[model samples]
Structures are given as structure tokens and as C-alpha cells.
Target: MRTIESYLRMLLIMTLCYLIAEWVIDEPKGTVLFNPYVLGFLFFIFLLVISFEVIIGVLERIADQLTTPEQRVALEEAKKQKALENKWKKRFAEWLIGKQTTPEAQLILEDHNYDGIRELDNPLPPWWLYLFYLTLIFGVVYLGYYHLFGGSDQKQNFEQEMAMAKEQIETYKKTAASFVDETNVTVLTDASSLESGKSLFEIHCAICHQNDGGGAIGPNLTDNYWILGGDIKSIFLTIAKGGRPGKGMIAWNNSLKPQEIQQLSSFILSLNGTTPQNPKAPEGTLINQ
Candidate 1:
């Protein structure tokens, strides 16, 4: 007589309790037992199921009290529902823990001649005993395979993982976004790269070079003369690795990525012959190439 909703609600509660218990047991093992989002979704479903059950139950109870005949029917239905529920529960309990006062447990009780106490020697579930045996056999096999005989070890696994990661990086580098340094990089002449480089220079190099590539404390970047060397490569090298000892230029390789350095160097190469107010005199060897 119990509605399907009641059985479904009990099943849901049992499932929730099982999952929560599993999480609690495994939380200390440092492995992620469940996704938080999934748990949140399950919790929401449980709430909805519980709320629907309560509302339906309340409405049914209210309707039953309105008439004596309806009330009597309701009482009888409630009794039948309780009995059915109890029957199902008892069956499940017996299946889970085995039957109580069975021949096996009785035999254990009689075998022990205690003065007044009887030890309830209920045998362990078959499923539990099988699993226990499985673990023991698995442990022996694992010990022999991993410790005694030759097998893949943690070191080999780690090395293999590192090798795979390195291969992936190498493959990625072949895809055009790899690191570019002054040695292998060429000046970008594209409009977008030049614009990006211009913005980068204004933000970083502007303090020393001043706005508009005009020299301030730093040498005139617009001039062809160069202390380090004047081509795209030398300018990039100077920008990346810095000037000679005590020349006030420090390695910019750390501040800027290789692509950015290439862009900024291209922008500087375009600055040759630009007019600047109070331009510092050129001090580096001029390269015509």
C-alpha cells in the first residue's frame, strides 16, 4: 500500500549515505573521491525528492481526516503500508548481515560452555570473506611481481612520464609558438607586430629612451649608431642580454618574452632616422646590413 515515492525516497537516502560513507573513508588517502559539483547536484535531487514526498504525504493525511469512511480507509492503508515497509526492511537486513539465530550461529553458541554468557557467533557474510581472501592473494601476487621478480618500478614510471612530457613540448615547439631568442629571431615587419612592439617599448623603454624614441638617459634609439651593434640581431641581443659591463643596460630577456623582444627590436629598427628632440649622440658601431 506504500506509494512508490516512499520506496524511491528510501533508496535515494541509502545511496546518499553510502556515497558519504565512502567519501569519509577515502578522504584520508589523498585521492579525490568525488567531484564537489556532482555531490551538490545529488544533494539538490535529494532535497527535491524529500520535499515532494512530504507535500504529498501531508495532503493525503489532510484529505483522509475530512470524512470517517476516508479516515478508516486511510488507517487501513497506513497499516498495510507499515507492514509492507517492515517486510522489505527485514529482508534487506537479513540479506546484508545474514539471518539471526541460524544453525551455524547456534552451533557456535552451543560449542562454547560459558557460565551465563552466549557468544553470538554469527558467521561473516560470504561476500565479505571472499573479498578478504582476495586481498590476501592479491597482496602475495603483488609482492612477488613487484619486489621479488622484475617489473615496472616507480622510477621507470616517473622517467617515462617525464619523457612523454618532453616529447609533447618538442612537438608544441614545432607548431610556431616556440621560444624565440635574439640569435635565431628575425625582425617582424608586419603592421600588427610593429604596433604591438611600439606599445611595449613605450611602456618599458620609454623611461630611459623617453617618449617618441628620443634619447634621455639612454642612447638615441633612432640613430644608426649603436654601442652594442646596430642590426636587428644586435639590437635584439642588446635588448635581451643587456649592454657591456656598467653601460647601464641590463638583460631584458627576463622582463620580455622572446616574441615581445623580437617585436620591440623590429620597432627599434624602424626608428632609424626619426627626428627626436634632445636626442643623445649615437655611441655604437653602425652596421649597414
Candidate 2:
């Protein structure tokens, strides 16, 4: 039970450390910045490190718990002997190497050398050698998934999706246009339709036309003056096809559906007699009657 509690406490400390590391690594970049992707990556790495620590800790606790008192004493003695043996071996190797001439010393050196300094052809420690080999294998697997299997290049994928979305919107507009007839230009005098039109206009058209349709950038639609035309169909056409080329008004036919243009034109008709705070001076022909 004590061992279990100790392990839990250690795990808690490790978890807190992981969280701190993640927070430090993923902190905001700019003066008031935030980055979700960096935060997410930090969280992922944190989880991996915590998992490794927990597994190793649990295994160590179990091994310690299983050891008998006598066995523990014997194990300590064995460890001391092992340490002494390693120390002597290192000393012997250094002594033997020191006795050799520099030219003779190069005979036992490996082919790889750095700046005339040659590495001794000593065998790698087993643990380090295994870890190095495992890392190589991990690299191959990571490369296969992230590069070869298209795990990366998310920006390219997003651009492709945007293009596809644009294409679908164009296709829908074309299909909606085919359904329009002369009678489709119904006046939105009904309260419900006018309210709906107001909402849509506020979201999509308010920036240019102003909320009350007393235009800011585009021509004012309140007074009976037709930059394109004042009639329902002409209004619909103007709004749908947009104003003249190089004009600030873009082609709404691409952005808005044909039905939306009809509703918007109806809304404009409703605002014919209404006044706004800053009405642009009337342009185009004045429709008398």
C-alpha cells in the first residue's frame, strides 16, 4: 500500500511537471497572442511523456515489491560489484591506450574520425545501442505516415476544400437561376418576408448598402431613382448581376442565390419612402410615379 501511494504521488508530480512543460512550450507568442496548434502539439507530447513515466514507474514499483529482504541485500551487493568491475575495466582500457604510441593507437580506431581525432572501436553499451536502433525504426515509421501517406500538407488540403466549396456554390447558383421566371420577382410587402429580408440584408449587404438601404457605397434605393432601374425585375437584375465593371459593387450572383436577390430587391422596394441618417445624394434617372 505504501509503495502504491508513493507511486501515485510520484505520478502526480510527473503529471504536474508535464503540464508545466506543456504550458511553457505552448505559451502565447505575441503581445496578446494565442496559438491552438502549438498548444495541441504540446498536449500530445505531454501525454506521451507522462504515459512513459507512469509505465516505467509502475514496473519499478512491482519489481521492488516482489523482492525479498535477503534478495534485496544480495542485489545491492551485486550492484556494488558490478560498479567496481566497470570502474576497473575503464581504468584498464585507459592504461592500455596510454601505453601505445599515437600512430599505433590509430590502428584500433574506427574508420569514422573527426578533425584528426579517431574514435576507438569499442562496442556500444547494450541499452544505448538498442535505443539508437529503435529510434531509427521510429524515424522510418514517422516519415512513412507524415510525408508518404499525406499526414502533412494540411494547408494544401484546406485550399483544395475551399476550391471545391466555391465550385459547389457556383453550381447551386446556376441551378437556382434556371428556376426563375417573370413572376418570381414577387414584392416582399408581407411582414414575415420583409423581416427575413432585413436579417439577410443586415448580414451580407449592410456594409455597403447600410442597414436602412440609404446607401453608403452603392446608390441609394429609397428614392425612386434607378441607377440600373427602379422596377422589381430591374432591381433584381441589378442586385443579382451587380453594378457596372470596376464599380465597388461585386457580382452578387456568385455569392447570393437567385431567390435571395429577389427577396433583397423586395426589401429595397419596401424602403422606397424611408429615410436614413446619411443618405448619399440621389444618382441616375428619377422615376416619376
- Residue pairs in clash, model 1: 226-284, 227-284
- Across residues 1-289, which tens digit of lDDT does each residue of candidate 1 receive? 2464486566878587657656665564433336575566666767877888889899988977776987688888998788687998756655555565656557765456578776766778655777889999999999999989977899999999999999997776667666676656787899999999999999999999977787888888898777778888888889998988786878998878988999999999888888988788776677565
Alpha-carbon error at 212 in model 1, in Å?
4.5
Clashes of 2: 0
Query: In candidate 1, where is summed lDDT lowest over 10 consecutive residues?
Result: 26-35
Best by lDDT: 1
Off by over 4 Å in 1: 1-37, 44-100, 103-107, 110-119, 149-158, 175-183, 189-195, 212-259, 272-289
Give the C-alpha lDDT of model 1.
0.79
- Cα deviation at 145, candidate 2, in Å, is 54
* Candidates' C-alpha lDDT: 0.79, 0.74
Compared with the true structure, what per-residue lDDT tens digits does model 2 show for residues 49-164?
A: 66876787799889989999999999989987886878865465444333324566557778877899877865454556678899999999989988899775779889999999
